[model samples]
Target: MKLGVVGLGSMGYGIAASLLRAGHEVCGADVNCEAVERLRTEGAMSEEIVTAAPDLHALVIVVLNSAQTESVLFSENGLAPKLTPGAVVICCVTVPPDFARAMAARCGAFGVHFLDAPISGGSVKAAQGKLSIMASGTAQAFEAARPMLDATAETVFKLGDSAGTGSAMKAVNQMLAGTHIAAMAEAITFGMTQGISPDTFLQVIPDCAGTSWMLENRAPHVVAGDYTPHSAVDIWPKDLGIVLDAARASKFSAPLTATALQQFIAASGMGLGREDDAAVTKVYARNAGLTLPGEE
Candidate 1:
């Protein structure tokens, strides 16, 4: 299959690599020329995404937010219009449910199929082609997208036969994921104040009842004091903000989510926006006058 992938960041690049390994002809685009070039060396198509759009059987959008997703599909010279009738747009970006529904309607007008398919399992799983996709769309959309889906996902949950359901599920996921990461940072730093080293906290927690996937996954970064971003601190603000907005719309109280958002905001304010999200511990450390591993 011929596919186009927009936004070749960590997860996007991994998805593109997986598609290439699956023997698909992949054309990748990114504002980062190096990412595009990097994927090209690994056998992705070198053609410009715009020039290749007309022939693409599917397009996977892994951009950061809904705005970029909209621009990719609906902006002037957007790829949606350029795609042949019956092509599928697999949107992996997390977005509002209403916005997903709206984009589906707009794409339908152009005779394109839109799948609200937000993904999880992070960059590692994406590169391994083991991602979990929470997807919803018309049956026809699923059929049109199956090839790329098979190439990219290990588990594909069919949520509903419409666009909004998938985004709704993604919102739920981000809410817990953001909250857990913040909670993990808080607990690890709080332990530090009691003279429990980050390394000791990591060693003991994963076996405990209180441990979570986020805690196990991110705590190693804190222990090693490595802030290099596999996922950045700034992402939580936008993602958790999305969760809070959706919560507010439903009259849901998300105090934990709100508190987590503030911690990420403070981390961003401390010039750690581009650092690994585990660096949220720094916010707590600063408030308590404690130093993290590398800083010490």
Candidate 2:
């Protein structure tokens, strides 16, 4: 398949690499010139994405939010208008259900297939071509996107036969994921106040009932003091904001999600926005006057 990938950030770059590995003709673009150059070295098409857009059979958008996704598809120099009819767009941004539906509808007008496909499992899984994709769209959209999905996803859950359903499912996953990361920070730091080391917390927690996927995945980052961003601290605010907005529209009270969102906001405020999200533990560490791993 001839594919175009926009964004080329951690997740986007990995998805593009996976497509390249699957022997697809891939053209990649990003604001980061280095990322685009790196993909070019990995055999991605050297032509500009705009130049490649019309000939693309599929375009995988892995941008940060709905705004960027909209700009890529509908704004000036948007690629949607340039795509051939029956081309598929697999949108992997974490966005609201309504936005997904709207993008799908607009793509329908252009005879393009839009897949409301939000992904999970972070950078490592993305690099490994093992991410979980929560996806929904028309049957034709699914058919159009299946090859790209197979190249990039280890698990693809077909949530429903419509655009909104996949985003709704992703929202639910984000709510829980955000809360668990925050809870892990709280518990690990509380243990430190009682003289439990971050290393000890990691050793014991994974075998305990309190262990969660987020806890297991992120706690090790804190233990090693490596704040290298597999997933950055700032992502929670946008993702959780989507969850809370949806919850609000449904008149749902999500006290836990609200609280977790605040902690991530505080982490960002503390100049850890670009750090790994496990650094949320820094908030608790500061409050208790405890030094964490990698702290002086």
For this target, which candidate reaches the highest lDDT against the unseen true structure? 2
Q: How well is each residue in 1-296 modelled by candidate 1, as lDDT tens digits?
A: 99999999889999999999999999999999999999999998989999999999999999999999999988997999999999999999989999999999999998999999999998899999999999999999999999888988999999999999999999899999998999999999899889899899999999999999999999999889898898999898998888899899989999989999999999999999999999998999889998888886
lDDT, model 2: 0.95
Q: Residue-wise lDDT of candidate 2 within 110-205, one digit each (tens)? A: 999999999998988999999999999999999999889999999999999999999999999999999999999999999988889889999998
Model 1, position 284: C-alpha lDDT score: 91
TM per prediction: 0.99, 0.99
Q: Candidate 1: where are CA atoms >4 Å away?
A: none
Error of 2 at 116 (Å): 0.3
